[model samples]
Target: MRPVVFDGQFGWLHPAAGPHGVVLCYPFGYDALCTYRGMRRLAERLAARGIAVLRFDYPGTGDSAGDASEPGRWRAWIDSITKAVALLRQSTGVERVSLCGLRLGGTLAALAAQQLGDVDGLVLLSPVLSGKNYQRELRAGYRQWLSMPAAMDCTPEPDTDEFVEAYGFRLYREALENLRAVDLRRDAAAPARRVLMLDSLDAARVDALAAHYREQGIEVERRGFDEYSKFMMESLDSEIPRAAFESVENWLAAGSGELATAARDADTHLSADDPQGHAVEAGVTETPVWIDGGRMFGIYCMPHASLVTTGGTPAVLMVNTGAVSRIGNARLGVRFARRLARQGIASLRVDLGGLGDSQPSLDTVTLDALYAQDGANDAACAARWLAARGHPGVVLLGICAGAYVGLYAGSREPAVTGAVLVNLQKFTWRNICDETGKPTVRVAAIGSTRSYLRSMCEPRKWLRVVKGQTGGWPVARELAARCASRLRATLADRIERITGLELGASEERRPFAALDARGVPTRLLYGVLDDGVEELEKYFGVRGARLRRLRRVKVSFREHMDHAILSASAQENVMSYFEDFYRSQFGEQPGAVADEPADSRDAGRSGRRARAAQWLARQARAFRLSGEA
Candidate 1:
């Protein structure tokens, strides 16, 4: 995967040996984040078939420079498609080009094709047909969330007169107006020779749109696809849509003779200013690195200007939160990293071994790998790597299971002067049962059982529990287990206090206490009504006072946020917490610079390799220091 800068936006290119190239335009906000890994996988599958492909974040989104605060972003997104098309054509020598867009991206692609009159073919996956209809759908989702049992404890809803915020981003009044105007049924059919539209989960919305295109003399094929919701819904472990991918592959494989000739002719008319007809700031730059002897993969984000100037090595290391990859839930880490870069603070968001692009660790597979056992080891390696590369004051940041890892990893690594733990689900390591029957682990729903217990307070769930469908013994056993667990924790705390040293609860066995002793500036944020909060109280007394009593440990109840931090308003709370933590713990720094092309490749390689070696050495030293070697 090659990261590129086009029209001041960040995108990844998968080069293929085929003559045709495709550009993948993603949907906006949370949908884009949820489907990122799936999209990346789709790109790889296409590339493997000898078709070069490009997947990009629209302007003010993903790893890009601007954000939702920027006005006229709706228009900018439409123009971005044109820029992406040009980029794919120029980067690869492919004579033919096709556009594949999901949701709003599909709409933008059609609009761009109309303007450029260059695209050879189009593929729309779950394309949004009418903006007004989409908005209503979003509003319906919001209402459903509001009525959920968990919403009772959420922070009071924020008042937004001009915008509707959801899934960590908002669409303004003007944007909604733009959406209302985007009725593809009314627009003239794009000049593409063939079009393929996949309806998500048999919503049956695209049939009429495709019929409209067919009436306009356009070749349109519409298919009902069930995996659309599976791909676009949020999950730690995303299941890539094999059927949909295969369909797209089969369609693209059927070639047209005019495709190449038309593509070449269109390339001749392309210019830098052709897309938006204005210059854009190339803000943050990314360098992909392979660490831990090439077993771990990460992307280092630096401000463009920081390339030339020598300064303090300040950076944040963000780990994969659950199975959601390095971008964090809803691309939160990406936005956080770019924001830090803009403030001259470098950050690395890495996929711990066996996740995303990172290779699996020895003795483990993707589905069964134990995250808690080796998370500290991986994070420690990451911290040491940053330290070796001149970043001395590194902060470890993670969410959910990633937070659990950061707590242990940051406690052990001196380079990690601070740590941010968001919505940590559990303190103890629990092995997940898999088909292999070998001890294995991935991101576990540790607090989900507690959530289920809370749900029993409702009469309907209680009825189910009493019925044979749920089994009464299982519920009773769960209650008994919770009581026993709390009893054990209470005894353990008492034993530690009496002996002045943990008896059975050693540093390795007890992460929270160890973290407190290490005196690292730690911030723990949990959702207001998250079941994890009850888990916290169970282990550390009411409000987690056992940990909060420590001078360096801080805890907060984040309002109006789910455990996943899925909403824009919730994300703002997370971002504000981090910004405050950085300022308080590390002080201020200069604004970061944009990309300097000369050093990005070579610098990243040598730096990553050297850091990998140092990390290994550091691990050896740590083992020796602890007498574990």
Candidate 2:
């Protein structure tokens, strides 16, 4: 095992024989730390075939320096990998390089390959094709968290960046926005070479994409890996798909002697505790920020360079669930912050109270209590945090229930300049079972007329009698008994009363109405296929025409793309839209922007383009509905 540093860009490098060549490997987030079975196996196989392999971590991800909340560093990540490739060539005397990536890494590799005039091959494993799809999945997960009953007691301080739950790390709005702007296929056009694509039998989209690549005359070959666990989710252990690895080895072994000989002689490597060599910079000052009366806490990411200023930069504050920290969210947040920073924009990903590293004070309140109060205090607390930082012009960006909080905050705070609500929801009901083994709606019922008459119209007395008498096998059975006793009762009336009260209370708060009056640009992003769309729309009166100037986007790509914006293709497309929107509104300036070339790789690629086009078309329809087009 050889540890190599290419001009301060650290990575794990495996050498191969014959003509020196390079293969850059990129891992999905979290997957970078937990498992590298597939990556390590591929590196060994390629190294044996004379292809040197190099894999490194993105800053604030594995072992790299800086915080994930710094959105201005995404380009830095791409630059680091590109520089690593160049350094690998200098270190090994390799004249040719092949880029290999898994998931988001595939998208990043594709982007890097497009800019570098390297004469080589490219391999993408289930690359993210759409950003909107990934965001949708993220939104869904957040909505699920919000729907849980108050008994779960899962609530983070509003405006904080971190959360702690059963799972490892959870990312918030900053991360989601950053991931939303990453796309690989947009400008990824490399010279046709031996392109190998691996797909799972169950992955119909990947299979279709592979077929499309083959038709493009790109020398593409598709190999199916059966029964391999998904590498994205943390649920899978670090187990290599041996069958898939061997297939790749066989394919490379059939290539030219230079490639084949290297494959046979390369060193066999083990999955290391940390393969990316990510290290934090020392002596970095960490400033603490308060949210929800110190119930939630966050660390501010200050600029490292003198040229980077906090002045006049549009600030974005993020919100997340109780499963991850601001740092995890920074994985995505840092990307956007970096991009925006390059454009003279600033952002902050806060740790909500009671989650991650943030410990609530005695006076700090819980999310359940805040929800009961319609999130007013929580929103004000976030606004005050920004105001103290001299960031008066702020944008409220949230995911899932975070969206709810953002809406609530934006509605109340006049300092808010804009609002980005992703996957918003109104109300969530918990399933309650009756003694008869059937699902029953849970609501407060009013006393019956007969009971009232018997009690001489004493409502309190009747209520006590019902509470004492209603015990038993099933709620329905008890209700029937009450009805038999000449008590007036109906599910519809009770439901109506509950719904009216909830809505009436919400309206009385006047948060959304205030936001509209404030003219704060509000952008609501959601998945067209999101199950919660109808539910969310029902509560927050559909702002049909209002969303146009506000810039709403509905991602319609893959049906299953989650909210994290994990899909490679979706990531690329969504980033394109994001960049376009940001540039259009913020004014594009030289040096403040990076030019991304048009990805013509799929120009001649027959089937993939057709399928992608169809998928994009469907997404386009959804975007049009939101007036994004």
TM-score of each: 0.77, 0.40
Query: lDDT per residue, candidate 2, 1-629, as tens digits?
Result: 34454443435667665464556556545545333435655675677666667776665563345544466555766677678787678766776677777766766776777777564676766566665675454445555544432111123224333321112234445555556675433355442366777756236656655555566556777766563454443312234556766766666555534453453312333222223322134312223444454455443444444434444444666654323334433254444544454544445666555333344311122334324334434555666667666764776666555676677777777667766665454343343544542336533242222222334455775566578864334534544654442211223223444674322224423554566577665555554434334343333322221122222222122222234333333234334544553444344441221222123223335577675774465345543333232
Q: Which 10 consecutive residues of model 2 have the lowest summed lDDT?
A: 543-552
**Residue ranges of candidate 2 with Cα displaced over 4 Å:** 139-186, 201-216, 228-236, 259-629
- Which number leads on lDDT? 1
Q: Please report, in order, the local distance difference test score of every candidate based on alpha carbons.
A: 0.69, 0.49
The residue pairs found clashing in candidate 1 are 155-560, 168-567, 168-568, 303-593, 304-593, 304-594, 304-595, 305-593, 305-594
Best by TM-score: 1
- Model 1, residue 379: C-alpha shift (Å): 2.9
Q: Sum up the clashes in candidate 2.
A: 64
lDDT of 2: 0.49
| Tens-digit per-residue lDDT, 124-206, candidate 1 | 88888877778877676666766564453445356564777555467778778888887676553654878998886325557
Candidate 1: where is the Cα deviation over 4 Å?
A: 147-152, 156-161, 200-205, 256-299, 303-313, 341-344, 354-375, 436-488, 499-509, 512-519, 545-561, 588-629
TM-score, cand. 2: 0.40
Model 1 CA lDDT for position 449: 46
